[model samples]
Target: MAATKGSLSINSENIFPIIKKWLYSDHDIFFRELISNGCDAITKLKKLSLIGEYEFKDDEESELKVQVIANAKDKTLTFIDNGIGMTAEEIDEYINQIAFSGAEAFLEQYKDKTNEDQIIGHFGLGFYSAFMVADRVTIESLSYKEGSKAVKWECENGLEFSMDDCDKTDRGTKITLYLNDDSLEFANEFKAREIIHKYCSFMPVEIFLSNPNAEPEYDTIPESEVTDKDTVIETIVEEAKTEEKENEDGTKEVVEVSPATTKAKILKRPKSISNPVPLWTKHPNECTEEEYRQFYHEVFMDYKEPLFWIHLNMDYPFNLKGILYFPKINTEFESVEGVIKLYNNQVFIADNIKEVIPEFLMVLKGVIDCPDLPLNVSRSALQNDGFVKKISDYITKKVADKLSGMCKTDKENYEKYWDDISPFIKYGCLKDEKFCEKMSDYVLFKNIDDKFLTFKECLEKNKEAHENTIFYTTDPVQQSQYINMYRNENIDVVILKDAIDQPFITQLEQKNENVKFVRIDAELTNTFKEEVNEDELKEMTDKLTEAFKKALNRDTLDVKVEKMKDSSISSMITLSEESRRMQDMMKMYGMAGMDPSMFGGAGETLVLNSNNNLVKYIIDNPEGENTDLICKQLYDLAMISHTPLNPESMTAFIERSNKILEIITK
Candidate 1:
């Protein structure tokens, strides 16, 4: 048949130029697109064979394979495939019309919602991507139909392409791209090999590239001289004697011995390269821990085994599969990097998927495979795909479930990792409401005694002692002295040290009724209600306030007296929790124009007991130097308990201590 004489009409005259210049950011993607198209054609042919629509040749080795050949001398790169080749008419219909998508039509016709293995390229322009790196492209193909004549199609920069019948017998397509001057690198063997390995290593079809420098294996045989004499030896002397005795009766049976030929040993050839199988596609139960560890090392190059792992497999709403490994994180939290890698169809999409998982969970290391991601034409394109939200939610739930399971089965191990993992979970709860709801049950709180307890357990244990209050301290070391005082009084205090603790506690306070977090050194008054009579408490407070003002010069100490529970004996200085927390924030932010003296300078209220002997002595002799010294010493001790004091104040306190020691020695 004569070549069809018809001109192709494009949506726009500049369409080809736009595609060549802007459709793909990377010129190397042209090879991936072309090879992907070849794989799709092969898949179509296999489907046709399976359905009995076409008769496949009865060849022992008929598997589909893609071959990439680089001819630097000819300045052409050829991509060949054993797929269902198109005829002259089919070429005129598909190749001539660039935008006509055969994949789109196939999907619309089949529409198997459950099958996710369908080919990815839906647009027919994948072939045209070659123009990005080629000045001219030619296609030679022979149809699968018997006696189908071969055809060739050629296209340059412009739309004026020529088609003609060609003399070819191969039953597949061979696309040869003439490299442009600037794109000659694609014709280099090394460069082409690299590009193929990066984009097509995981492709279903086997890809072959010419390796001229590869060494060949050979077998060795020992040299031997041949002897001309033909001799026959028999080892039948004993056997023939027994047979002769039996032959007297039988008279017919005779034994004959034959010599067997021996061949030389042959050596097996060594395998060159082994292809790595994608483990992300396999079922979790079928994989062993060792296999998972090996796969992790292959993908991440981390020799150390993971601490734990979660295999995520979900199909509803969206398709997702991956194994998330929690690597051994021993270094500072800030040093952890490149935790999660995103993959689509067993191909790595990106290593930094910080947006996919919550920022707090950034320490988690693993891969996430979601086939529904709307990758841009470049396959490198990442959009705010609607499916990403669902994927994120699913991952968050899985992580929460794993953590909850650990807490239930291995409490000690969970506690060991709690400090390191708490920051992430806290941040997740603070930022993601849904994640918080799922993770709240597993959040562990450590009390002052070094015991780990869940929030509900802590609340239950302290219900009676800490009525209408949830006391928590930010700095355990700074406030440890107060813990002893509270413990002595049978009050429970939780240690909350993270930077986010203050804000988180505040949020929890608002959410929970009649419950609030108060710093250990926040106030002189006890968190629990006082058992002393109101009249007696008022009398003691007035006397202690007057005596304290006289002992420490009234101008230096802005001290207010309040009666605390009898269990909290003598006296203690306290700063309001909110005020102290704000000061910490101000210091962190380095807010300028703020008065430094205002911070650490606020007057602490001093609650004293009139019944205590120290209080009685200070009140009876307020004008004495002994009273003044004791007042300064007590205040300094209180400051030391909350935070380190200035050098000047510390020196004064030390000097006073020495003087008291000298008096005792004398």
Candidate 2:
């Protein structure tokens, strides 16, 4: 190889500026890109060794790794890897070209002989990400070819780069970045180490950090100080009780005292930031509960333990390995983007990427490493290609399978976590039809009676009476009267309190034919039985409607009288299910810039109980403030029970109550 100079193959002269300012969202990602490229080169060497195409020296036979060297004085950061180095021709083809992929080109050249997925990097833009932090980058590499000379390549954030033979005779690649003034932080040993630990915590290769003139701190003490066997003592205390009763958490502690438990173990802390063998790389049977929890906290930085996790491992359809955790919902992170760290192999790419992760699943915190992820040059977003769709579908299916499996094997445990996980399930059903179909059976509801039942159980339990209808309540407090009324009739009402549930019900009904979910307060279900005939009810309704009109002065008010079994209640506000949905939609989007209270405009239905003694009394004395007071109170009671009262209505109710109190006292 001889000295040569050439301009990079790029269309725009401002490519480096675009890469620095807009290519990657975070500036710290330059280290990840550069280091991952080094890892890719190492993997290529391993693959070639396994295929018997290349022989490795005795030193190359050991474990392969990536090392980071940061020199603050020189303001330079370097990445070194024990992997396949590039020849002069290879550098001209791969480095000079901007978007061309060297690994992909190699795979095509050795299509019949090599495994295509062994390579970790696909985009050539990784090397240029260095320009985001540095003004100039240099590469010194010696190819594994029999009589190869060391080659050096240098470019100062521009298309013109020089490649020449160097004095270096190493068999691997070394990438050195001369830090720019703005990115001098990367040259700091502490900053570079922190960035490496954050992004390369679980990379497949062993990554060691080194700083010049650094003092070595030793945690490996003398063998005499270390104990070969350590005993842990345990104590137990029993609380005596008269009878075994379940706690609110659904667990009961029995009063029984046994021997103290003891265990032996060696105590040692982790030495490296990266786990060479990650949880996802191992089989589910081999994984322990403690290991899963450890990984969860380490990756998400979530302090609380996860409710459960799904281990995804598939090699055939596409190599996908991951651990998706169902974090306790309603945490401080409910509004934050979840920590679903996406990866290519073990190298992290991004978090909460919609193309790789289903939008609903993005609510979860986990890691998904798939070499098959079709990433673009920047490696920030997924490419609009077909294989990425398969990866997304596979993840959705795996999650549905996990939820369904847990329900079948452990009903008690499934219900224990239903409240926290229901929102995720409902959102998944609303967003994905395939997920809806898979999760429809496992979709659960907690009735007001504190019973957990799936969709089928709910339907079967209420089928004879409610008939293909599932009555639910969005606000337990506001709908308590209706809930109590339903309970008196031995009717069960499911609680749908999550904000997403309003739209989720529509999807559920569309998926399950002939099944409908109506809000308990929105309509009167068949649980209420009316005895009075239509003619008798209409005549009484006509009299009561006329007397109440003047008291409740709204001219367009629609009030229907019904003869109910419960005569204690005079009136209950009823809105059609259709109207309630319309109101919710309008309120969510806008009510024509008007106050949301106008949603009760023409859709408000006040169903008065004709069987109530108060209605009969009002109709008989239908002429004075005595009748007006009772009518107003009845209407106000219904208004408060149905929804929160507007300020105007609340003030009026207070004044009327005071007037009634004064009159009674006089």
Candidate 3:
């Protein structure tokens, strides 16, 4: 082949400048791109050998290795790799042509049924990322094929490039970068070593740093002395005959010689920082308890042994491997970011993969590895790719399956984790429809009496009496006074206190058929089942509202007096479920800091029970002088039963109680 010469000619004179300015944020990535190409070439050669297209020499051990050498005096950084080097023709075709990738062509031709492991590179732009940090780049390579001569290609600013033959004996490629003034930092050995360790630690080949004076380890030993037993015995016998050893003053004793001591040798071992065996890459069944616990601690330094773990290894729609842990949720602690780490080929891409996993799954602490995730020209590119979405769906389904199994086999344990996992599950149910549908069967609802039941079970237990309505309370302590009221009527009120419960319930109500979730403290909760005539109820409601307004100053009692069934309570202060839930959510999202004027609202409504005798007496005896005092007392009692009352209002009520006490004393 007569050199197959070619030149890279672009339409615009400013194209190289545009590429340098807009395409890459950093220039060091160029090294990654070039090294990746070398790896890809080696991978292709291996595949060719497997298919009998190429044969390796008996003496030639083919293993890819990347070498980085920095010349501070020359302001040059060289990245060398011993892999399948390109030929003169390949240089002309692949190197001379900008934006044209051999990897892309290989994938386009063989991607349909080819093994992905055999293909590593995609875009040729990785080479260009180097331009971000370098002013000039030179390539020196010799084709891996026998009888191929070495070639050299040089380019500056991607504008003009030259290629020629060079005398070389190596079967590999070397990329030398002339660092720009701004990128001199990468010319240091320490910086280069850091980059290699970070980006290429787990690369297919072992990367060696050229350390000329590397420290050597050795063991220290002490000399041991050999003793002559006969000589020692003769000396001891002479000493015993010549002199008597005396102890203190009165008694004579024989002296004995002490043996010499010897020191043990101490050996030094090489330090290893890399975790060669990643936990996710291992078989779940083969992993021991100690291994999983150690891995969890290594990944999350502060977290204790996880409550439980889920090892997911799936290769269907996409290849995925991960070990997810259900960390013990400390109710007192707030949520933290970066709990789940996302990995590509056993290397962590980032600790915070919020986009990869739903925000609700943030409570999960684990690692996820997927090799098929697509990266842009730079491996640094991170976005919600198709494979990521598919993997997320798979994980969600797996979690639901696990929970469902646990619920069936271990009800008590499942219930114990329900409160801790409820916030995450409810948030997911409210945001992700697919997850919601799958998780609906596993979500457990706890009643006021601390009994756990699934949604379906609760509905079945209360469908006939409550007319398919599910009544829940946000604060069980505040709503306990009304629990007996509902119990007397054989109605079950679910206890839900999580900040996300309101929105979750609303979403559930929308999805469920003919189902409603009414708060236990909502207006008309006591009369939900009453069957009264509209006109007669309206008359009784109006009379009661007027009487209460007169007995208690209307400004002091912000209430809605309504007629209820004879069995219902006399008066109760309640908050609308939606209003309360919205407020809770607002606080959760940091919206509560706004001025009160922004909300344009007052306090919640007070529902007065007209059927109670105490309320009826206060209404009928409006002429009595103590009517206002009695009405205020009743209002305070209702407010206390519904929720914690305002401190100022409680103080005023206390003073009023003291006055009544004084009267009784008189």
As a TM-score, model 2 comes out at: 0.81
Cα lDDT over the full model 2: 0.81
Least lDDT summed over 10 consecutive residues: which range in candidate 2?
Answer: 228-237
Q: lDDT tens digits, residues 236-334, model 1?
A: 222222232346567675455533333222332322121324666778888898988987887677877777788988878888888888777655544
Best by TM-score: 2
**Tens digits of lDDT, candidate 2, 1-666:** 557777778645325444577668888998888888887888788888888979876665665788899998899999998788888889888888776678888788778887766476776677888888888889999988788888999998755799999988778899999999999988888898788877887777778787775664334333334443322232233333354667889999664344333333233422455676789989999999999999898777889889999999899878998899999866444563467988777877888888888999888999988888788766778889988888889999999999999999999999999888888888888889899888888888888988888888888877888788888888889888888888888777899887888788887687679999888877765458576677887787777888778888867677888777888878889987877787778778766445345555446778888778888788678885599899999899998889999999899999999998999999
Cα TM-score per model: 0.71, 0.81, 0.71
Measured on C-alpha atoms, candidate 3 has an lDDT of 0.70
List the candidate 2 regions with Cα displacement exceeding 4 Å: 1-27, 48-63, 86-114, 142-151, 159-171, 213-220, 223-271, 331-333, 511-514, 523-530, 533-539, 592-602, 658-666
Local distance difference test values of all predictions, in order: 0.70, 0.81, 0.70
Residue pairs clashing in model 2 are none
